[model samples]
Target: MPAGPVRTRDEVVTALRDSAGVGMGYVPLGAAFGILLVTSGLEWWWAPIFSVVIYAGSMEFLAISLVTGGVGLAQVAATTFFVNFRHVFYGLSFPLLKVRSPIGRLYGVHALTDEAYALLATRPHAQLTGPQVLATQILCHLYWLTGSTLGALLGAGVGLDVEGLGFALTALFVVLTIDAYRSAPDVGTLVLALGCAALALAFVPGGMLVAALTAFLFVLLGRYTLRRRRVA
Candidate 1:
């Protein structure tokens, strides 16, 4: 793929400005996570620690329960691996090459959340630069950090009733699913997903998500095999 022209700091600034609208959404969601963390019986400071360290949006929410429940590290590690396994595929085509320096590319990989990846994917590769990509990712991270910090403070100070905040992650996923379906508009994929979900629910209710994803992987593999055979 062709690289965009080398951009100056001003271009990076413009990219940040363009992303500002979408980045704003992160703040409230991050704040919700913060509230949940505090209410889950953790210190307010844990909000920033999770935001900066774990940085896994929905998984961080799950982490609250995991920590509270005293789940073992092995389970947490395995769960995290399965939950975030999709990122392996994201890196395959992500514009990591556009990042000029090694350090920038490292950060780019670390910051490649669903939002950043979706925003970057929308732009033409030829129009994107290292700095612009980095700027968008950094801006999104900052938004989350700021929101979570504020939420933690609010929770600690006022003790707001935030029991409903847990639904925020579910709502976010539903929105993402709708956007994905609209973008692809594939009935076969939808059918396969539904089938997987049903099977997982029936056989592995406790690990439905992992089970469904595993089944989907098999379906995809079979499809790929048939395609390759036909091509040959």
Candidate 2:
């Protein structure tokens, strides 16, 4: 594929501005993860390693416990797969085609977090250049790395009991969801998502996230097919 257009100065600024809010969330949340990891008895350096290697925010937390508990490899793989299965759906609309360089595309895939998806996988940023998209992801990753490293260092020194820090992830998701809703404001899609969640909770509570995502994915494909047929 051809390389994407070179990013302009304005595009660079735009990417920075776009990632700023996500950075704000990531710093504290990553700090929470770092602090938890340190307090859980892991070395402070492991925090950055986890952020760099794992990069999956929620799964990284689960991984700390899994590692400390000595969970088996197969079980850990399964857990990681299920926890991040939503990324399959995320990829369906993640604007990756905008990033045309092979190297840029590879890193973009690796860095595709919820925050990046929320910021770039939308109409507003549809015109983002490859460099712009890559820059946004890079900035977000830096924010997370910095936050986790600082938190780990602090936790190792202070050993403070920072309860309720895990809730930062949930708070960040809520904010992103609100922003997503505000951007699109599609009542039908919102209602469908809620309905899918309700069904998943009612019938598959143990696998609610997977079930809900599956149901929503199928319903969305069905809607798309129907709309295409109507157009035809």
Best by lDDT: 2
Q: Write the per-residue lDDT of candidate 2 for residues 1-232, one digit (tens) a residue.
A: 3333334566778889988888888998888888999999899999999999999999999999999999999999999999999999899988888888999999999999988988888755456677788888899999999999999999999985658877876788789889888988999999999999999999999899999999999999999999999999
- Winning candidate number (TM-score): 2
Tell me the tens digit of each residue's lDDT in model 1 across 1-232. 2344444666678877866754566777888888878888999999999998888787888899999999999999998988787677567657778889999988888888877776676466787877888888888889888988888889888876666665655565566566656765879878998999999999999887778877887897898899999999
Per-candidate TM equals 0.75, 0.93
TM-score of 2: 0.93
Lowest summed lDDT across 10 adjacent residues in model 2 is found at: 1-10
List lDDT for all candidates, in order.
0.80, 0.88
Error of 2 at 61 (Å): 0.5
For model 2, the superposed segments whose C-alpha errors exceed 4 Å read: 1-7, 124-126
